[model samples]
Target: MARSQIQDVIRCQYCENEPAVFHCVPCGDELCPRCKVFHLKSKVPSGHNIVRLSERLHPANQIKMCEVHSSKAYEICCKVCQVPVCIMCIQEVHSEHAIGKIQDLYEKLKAETIEELTTIKTQLKSEISQRIKDYIMGEKGIKTSHEDIREKMKKQAQIFINDISAILAEALQESEKDERKYIVEIARHTAEAENFEQTLDQMIEKWETLTDSTHPVELILYRKQNPDIFKLLKLPNKLSIVMPSFSVGQINKSQNKHQFGKLITSKVNLIKSPVESSKHIQPTMSAKGNKSKKRVLERSVKTSQIKAEKRKLCYMACRDDRSAYISGDGPGIQLIDRSGTELDNISTDGEPIGLAVMLDRSLIYSEYDNKVIYKVALNKQKTEIISTEHNPGGLCCTKSGDILVCMGYRGTARVVRYNSTGRKIQEIQTDQNGERHFSDPFFICENVNKDICVSEWNFLKSKLVVLNKSGNLHFTYDGHVIASILKDRFQPSGVATDSLGHILIADRANNAVHLISQDGDFLSYILTENDGISRPYGISVDRHDNLWLVEQEKACVKVYRYL
Candidate 1:
């Protein structure tokens, strides 16, 4: 059976012909498809079992082995020749040249490829993470921008609504005034018409009685005699009647031509930074000397160098060793210490113009705007309104506890004395030398012997006039020096008396506080620097002989303590 199976199956390796016997006997296998002998046994070394071939080729028996030298298979590459070769080829042709094994070269190449791919993957992950973060941040920014836009739009809409509401309120008020005027006019005209009709009816009744059939001659005589009555009964010159028109559109158009939307669009503006409504205070620092030019406080006591705090819209009154009282135009009075720290606040509805402390420490203030005097308790619980006949401007409490008021501007500057129970007992300064004591008296202060000193505004001379308790002319302290310095007419606003009986006047127009002796001697300036006192309005002297000055324009209060 083995002989019959191999009968025609054996073919040449290079030629398609049956081979009688196998030609290449290295593997001892027949060729197929072509009768070319790929490998053959070495004839020179016949029994050595060595293989050779016409050309280098793969072995038919072993897939990975070389046919020429199967024992020395392809295990290395000739680096110089750049070709795969066996160990035998290295010894034959590439022995002296550099060579490397195929497995080692392949491992190195594989490691490099793996490293490069890993690096590329890491870079891609980092790039993707950054892109995601950027996208999220961009989205958040867009959201915030949209919210801001919406808030701005809402504010704009509210502004428009407020504008419209204000306009409507004004229109309603005008309409109310017009309606009242029209109604009153119509009522007056109707009453006049009724009176005219009644007069005509009375004349007709008299004429009808005279024209009765029983008295023809009497009627003629009566008509002839009473011709004036008929003339008087005639309707007086065409009743001047005025009928109101209901065409509010024409009136509204004539007054307010612009529509609500157009008006708002034209007038509405977005305010970026509104001005603060609080008062502003100026701080005081050391001034440089004239010759030495060194910054120093003028007074010996450092406590005299007072610093300003937050300013308040108020009028400054009395100042003692510990505190000063500030009466605001609003509804409260603030008590501040020498350090400008607020200690207490007392509430009063009346705007206090002038304040004076009684001997018992009770406070009395004149409400010039309300034309009344009020007594404020130290405990801030009791407040009594003392009704005065004159419109009081300035007030002063005497050593005897009698209150004196300066009635200004009414041409009747009279001082009325009030008891502790607020009773008017005496009238002082009524008429001096058969002429009025003052045209407009502003301020009053008492001396140690209860002698009163008053400041009077002389409109004729445009100067200040001083008067004593007996209505005797003391002196006229005009701003002569101040007028020379400012080159204009200077007016004095406030006056005070110190412990030494020195007079201090606030020369407001010159922005300085002037000091004078009781006998009208012009002393040295109390405050002369521009930065020290600005628009000084009120002046007061504490028990310590220090000067408390008020800057009305700047809403500030400054204290200057004497050494």
Candidate 2:
């Protein structure tokens, strides 16, 4: 070889004048391309750890597996003990605890936090902006009206008016504080989310790339390695916006003296209950029906069917993300994704019949035989949240996070409300006349106005019952009375409400879904057998106002855009 060429060539481990690329760490040899291939192929040096010079190891990216159980990865975490535990460790010590895979837990937490973050952006943020705009826009009118009224009123009346002005000012300040609190929370949460999201993205990329590649040794070595970035998920910002109320009521004569009447400027947490609804909310009981049809109603028709397993769908509820849940005929509650795939199957003691999902994805279901209500956690753990005296039927979670269950049987039917922890808060049985409001109350739902709608069924009396939040019988609807059509009783099985204050009832016998206006007038038959809906029992409306009707006999959930 020439002297200059020989000097330029990096020597292989076994020979000189050979250009080298890879360094075998275990063999401690900088190998040329041919030697590296030979080393990987040879029996003695085949298992050596090799790395390219350009790909030097970073200490920060290195992960350590379980030390005690050498070579075993530690993927699972014992939440109760607050420690990382390997699968072997779970069988040894951390058995029967709230154990979760670090990756799974992080993803779940991220999804929830992101959902809330989106809510803050879309609903809370938009609502605050509109509220400010409304208040500001109305300020000029309010000032002009007040000034004109002040000239006409006495000094005491003017003082009362000034008091209202002060109240409005205080309301503005409270709203500003609310807006500022949300702004800070969003900023802090965004920063934290960005950091964690980037870290997770890199980790997931590495995991996917390495796991998919033919690196058996590295895969085996890091099989159970769990990242400690899990703590970032627990630090999620639970931003809840509490909208304030600023009301200026009418001035009524009391003891012939002028006073600031009903200045409602209470700043209440909106996450708990309904935010600032006007007193014009009429109970579903007193729902005044309109016989005259003014506007042409757009009915919901079956657009497509969800590819689910069985046709015997007893009851179903749509989650916030449009995922439909149903109780399997046998054991466990089934969670179906948007593609109709059973993403999760949670085992329970017995088969739950009626299922309901809260806004927060809390799956509240009822056990048919036992008449019990349960809340299903993310880890497939079942917690008995409500035990009813009567056999509980369908379950629904109110906007205030209260659980409403159909607790009744033949001859005695009623609706009952309970707190989260299986505690019965109140029971509604007979109405003001001491007469039973329902007979065989099966399915129930709470409206935006907190009204309870029950589908009461019996061979003798089949009717749809609607009561106000206070248990007052507002109205009772017996199916659409059309003698020309020769239809039987309503025999409503499933009930749900839409954003437009409309009550939807699924009638299995009639093979139709009756749309009732919020005021209790029969809007129209939104769905029928003609619309590819037959034996439609369990039904619900998704966020997009699309009707998800489960035809039990057909064993499918059909989606339709009505509203």
Candidate 3:
């Protein structure tokens, strides 16, 4: 009784005579000790959360009252108006509207609020933290790039200085040699003049002494010795000094980056909202692992075949959805459409061994006759982009507009990367173990992950060599053991990668195209002899993810929708 009467300001809502002792959470009912006993006898709902008045979800006796009927508390909620109503209001204005228990709606909304808070505290926060870290890393990358560019500029200046010093030293040495020879000739002439003067003085003194004196023998002997001296002494031919001259050359004002080098700045946006990410994100479904499902090659259908005049098709580079560039043991590279109509022709010195296209639709190709890579612009103007030290076998243009060249001379093979303007950026030759990465890299491609994939063949066996963007050796894939028909004759000719990071290699000897996971695991033969593909040499993936294959035997390009 004393506990019930502890507080007088708050009385029992059920029995307003004593202070409230207990509260029902679901019903929102306040009860005193005396009223609580009667309320329990009235058969309250099961699992009703009842607690002390102090522990109530709301303040004691604070139930919401209907605004239309001030004397009544809200119990039912109108579904149509979404408002709480009392018994009198429900019977009058809310009679036509659907009604629900107000307590149920309150519980549902409460649960939803709690769930949203949890998500904000966990997942949303974590995502924000990760993005911040990525931003910081990007900042560091920019600074590193700045320092690297400065270092390159200093190195190039040093090279120019060294070259000029060598030329100047050679010129100075030649000039000094000419000066020494001129001085020797002048000294010899001076000595001859002095000797002639001395002989004249001696002859004059002898003639005077012979005129005054007595010995006829001395004068006679002197006349005999000096007989030709009186005739004439021809003066030495006049020596005119011929000085060395130097002409200064005019400085080249052309700011071509290929001559020296230039820094290229690219715009990068790192912030992405969920809605924006869906549109900007690449199709990375292939990167997702599917270990549970068995790998199988889906049947490929040739959607279109493009006939070409060149019998030996070597490489194919897709320019867009409508057209592609094809090269082989031919005089020029032909740009053709699906209907086999020639759109444009790029003349080459000889057969183009490597072919690729830039993002701007410019054609990049390397000819077998020269160790140089050339770019053909949209105006049909061709310019030398890169001059490699060795003959380039294949060329690939990366998403960032960099070119990867597969080059080798004699037994040495390597993959070199250059920026769009032809400055050497990277060279992937030996691995961490100092071992050669490829025997003969014939074709090259960049994967979705920026891994450099090279099709290497040494006539004995062919392999697919893959390296990470940092030029580290990722893996090397020889032909799968199950390919018994290509046991000893597996020759990887053309290599390409798709949006899924899956690598596809054309096996010219086996008449198949092998698809493998980016991790170097053999997936399946996407195109085989059964699919009417014979001597598939060059392969490429279009912007729409369609596979383009050049069939050497058919002298045609086949577009397949294997994906």
Better candidate by lDDT, 2 or 3: 3
| Model 1 spans with C-alpha error above 4 angstroms | 1-314, 458-462, 482-486
Model 1 poorest ten-residue lDDT run: 277-286
- lDDT winner, 1 or 3: 3
lDDT of 2 by residue, 1-563 (tens): 59998677657766655777777654567787777777887676225567774453543123447865776656667877656677677775567689876656656656766766776676767877987897786777677766866665666677777887998899888889988887887798789878877888887887787779757777666655654445455545666756656576774568344333333332334343243331122121132232121233475555666756653677788874447787545766667866677867777777777788765566778876786778876545678776666777888888888888887686657788887666788888897888988778888888867889999887887988999998999898888865543266667898999766789999888788888887799878877766667787888877666778887776777787775
TM-score top scorer: 2
| lDDT for each residue of candidate 3 in 340-376, tens digit (9 for 90 to 100) | 9998888888788888999777899997568888999
The global Cα lDDT (0 to 1) of model 2 is 0.73
Count of backbone collisions within predicted model 1: 10
Which is the winner by TM-score between candidate 2 and candidate 3?
2
Give residue 495's error in model 1 in angstroms: 1.2
How displaced is residue 419 in candidate 1, in Å?
3.0
Off by over 4 Å in 3: 1-297, 483-488
lDDT, model 3 = 0.81
Task: Record all residue pairs in model 3 with backbone atoms less than 3 Å apart, i.e. clashing.
Answer: none
lDDT string, candidate 1, 306-373, tens digits: 33342534356664666777764455677778777886777666777777877766677887777888
For each candidate, give its TM-score against the true structure: 0.44, 0.49, 0.48
- Whole-model lDDT values for every prediction: 0.63, 0.73, 0.81
